[model samples]
Target: MNEILNNLLSLHSESEIAEFKEARNSFDFNKLGKYFSALSNEANLKKLKCAWLVFGVKDNRTVVGSQFRTNLQDLQSLKKEIADKTTSRLTFVDIHEIEHPDGRVLLFEIPAAPQGLPIAWDGHYYGRDGESLGPLNLEEIERIRRQNRASDWSAVTLPSASITDLEPAAIEQARENFFQKNPKLVQEAKQWDIATFLNKAKLTINGQITRAAILLLGKAESSHFLNPASATITWILKDRDGLERDYQHFGCPLLLGVDEVFHKIRPLKYRYMKEGTLFPEEVEQYDPYIIREALNNAIAHQDYELGGKITLVEFEDGRLCFSNVGQFIPGSVESVIQTDAPESRYRNRFLIDAMVNLNMIDTIGSGIRKMFLIQKKRFFPLPEYDLKDNRVQVTVIGRVVDMAYARKLAEYPNLTLEDILLLDRVQKRKPLTDDQAKYLKSLGLIEGRKPNFHISAQIANHSGERMQYIHNRALDDQYYKELILAYLEKFGTAKRVDINGLVLDKLPNVLDETQKYNKVKNLLQALKQKGLIESEGKSWRMSKKI
Candidate 1:
């Protein structure tokens, strides 16, 4: 702390990497997060290791003391508050308090943004311009992101590693996958020795083991050759309450370990109606290809440099989460789905190519898109990607999330996968951009306003979900008025509360309480205007003319 204080004192002026404020009583939590993003980005741009946010210091470097976040608990809560809103849940690296004869000073150390990824607060990139905190300029955001175009880490050769470090069993599996992907090489593959086979399979460079070979085919103990890089995958099974039921960890020679991990997962039977058929078809809860693709992608993209092992977790409730460390190369899954070819840059080019040559993953950049399509074919929820914490987490749901939505999908085989994916988002109540919403609206495939959308009546009715269709559809105003009139006639009179009690629950559950109330109010106004009923003080009654 003394050394850091001296370093700041040496600067003697607020710059891009340092900000000073006299926060004697308190400071805005959101503003603190903005500073976190701004300072972190500024540090990255300035090529500094850390940025500082000092409280209790004047612009002129005078220490007046700070009562800001004086309570230790409140001060700690700031970490969670800031992390929850920032990209990758980034928060202060450390918070230090030093008591001086003049006053107590708080120093917040913020780590620089990761290479190629800028820090963002609540979706907006932030940076410091001189000493002012604000949105990161377009040029700066691009500058940081461009760093991703650097050389791939996995492609680098391991100087001392050799074929001896690779397990024979893993090499055999790799050979089989290689031949399976390239059947023309079957006869030739059988004749090649281990060294020749590895070179032919792209797993080795001139008989010397590359990082890719060590990662995928190295013996478990030989993982140390990658020093500080983790070559392990952890699979855990959890109950509904999130209690772990079982867990198994697999080490290097992931070529064989991936299969072991797959074997541990118990994908039970899930029965759903076959498209256009009344009879149900029983299929495995998870598609085999989908599982392999997800796992292989994790292995191929794992940021070994980050020293975090891949994790795959299965829940009793029928969902699988595959997680690996590193920024998602494309940044968003949508980008991957929309792109015409493989990503131009990868964290592990050699490893990914090896996986591709082994038929472990598709090299055409269609793996994620294919996973979504397979889930869609099964009438299951689309795979979800949660990109944060310098990691990518993918969740594949086994069961149908919305039966009505799934049934609609089955009934409309003509709908494109993209359309089905967009509709799935609607059914799940996830937000859609204006362009997506507009496209669906134009096709009459979805209705209601932006953000709160439902399957269009045309689709619902065609799909044989007339009930859901009717529920979402608003009936003629006259019909609700008739219900109000009938209630009035039955009891001779009724209060507004009584009328609401009779009709609110009967209204579509999709409408919120406020919308339900508004519907009931509209009905009453319609009835009164038509002279069928009149307000009798707080009560409503049939008109005497009736």
Candidate 2:
């Protein structure tokens, strides 16, 4: 019932917060309780909000049609059974029934264990070790217990930090940015001194310089105040081969360092002719706001405690990459886009607040989505975020990868940003959810099965992909069978190889040779079933009556 179920179903295999089971006909009730405990505890340790136990699916994630607890009342009763045995009377948050094309699916939403408390079933604590259920080990139990007690690294005050430790120019810039964001405060901002300005901008808390203050406004040499936590941003230029061509590093007063980094990379003008326009439009290689927002985001969200510096790489082509050392506080980029609100938790709460107050970044959580939208408007590839190994890496492309497809998507004003995003995946030949594939197919905007789709003629003409569409298009099976019949009538007898050779090139180019051969095989079977053709040994011939 939850939208997250769609994302989970798209997962190729079980995860710490998710499990799949066939459960066809029925399943043991106690096994469900054990899984509930395992998933809930695993979710907490992994810093996830909830876990899932999916029924009607196998270990390989195949939907084999589950019949477990078919009766609504019986399904409802299982909740009480689980609660009676769990450590905190914890049962499923909700049991959702989804009607999937393959079969009926049951999704059990299990809330993560409360902070500092490990979930248990019948007095035995449980957790997921990879994909298998097991006891919550002492180390893992302690990890969950320590989650809430962990201190905020960015909020700590540096005793030796003072107003002199901050760069005067950086402070002036912060004030100017603040005024620009709040034009009404112009005269009032001029009246206040440095201390008042710092406090008002949320850079310093009660005149005590915080780690955030030193990181953003402190002088270059003042970085030692946040010892072991590097207040550095590195910019590197790479050639086409990905070899480092040049590099520059900036430290402290990140407010100014952000600009220094921006200056190091060039944003050249690029020209492109639109599909329907006679004239060409010229735009900057990279949008300035996007560049600033990306750099500021890296500074605001970097895990400085890790002692790793934020890195920006500019490719010789037209791409920029920004990476910060830390797990994305929101867990997933999808959560950031879908929530569209300030996150409840942040790795650098104080730094983020200060940056927002200084107008360095937006606080409404729409910044990332806005970045995606801006690129979409420019008819360029959407920004790609790769979050893994406790790091968040984002890549922004300046030019269009497929000009026609990008233009087609840009011209469609009625399409929602989300729809455009999914369509972008279709154009790139990426995997799609079954529901997504079905919706696009119904609109005649896409063709082919999941994971291997092509833009359909309905939208391809506008995208300048009409020829591509024709090449990818599939004709009716009856037509292919008719072609086979005609071929046999002329040749009298033909080997399987001959039939394959005759039809392979006619099949959609989107399909591989194996798929093309398979298509011919299916057409041959259909012809034999209709008695229009008969196979003798390895060859096929027209039926005597026909």
User: Candidate 2 — which residues are off by over 4 angstroms?
Assistant: 1-150, 278-280, 461-464, 475-546
- Residue pairs with colliding backbones in model 2 are none
Q: Per-model C-alpha lDDT, please?
A: 0.84, 0.83
Worst 10 residues of 2 by lDDT: 273-282
lDDT tens digits, residue span 337-438, model 1: 778478877877778888889888877878888898888788888998999678999999999878888788777878887787788788777889999999
Candidate that would win on lDDT: 1
Candidate 2 lDDT over 1-546, as tens digits, reads 747667877897788889998899888877888899999998887778789999998888777778888999999888998988986466787899888888999999998876555777888888887898888899998987565447567788877779999999999999999998889999999999999998898888899899998999999989999876799899999988999999989998899999999988885987886555622488888999899988999888876644678999999889999998766778877778778898777767778888888889978889998998888778888888998655789999988787667667755757777777788887666789999888888877787765568877778776667787888888777788888888888889999988888888888877777778887888888888888889899999998867
Q: Score every model by TM-score.
A: 0.74, 0.65
Clashes of 2: 0
Question: In candidate 1, where is summed lDDT lowest over 10 consecutive residues?
Answer: 271-280
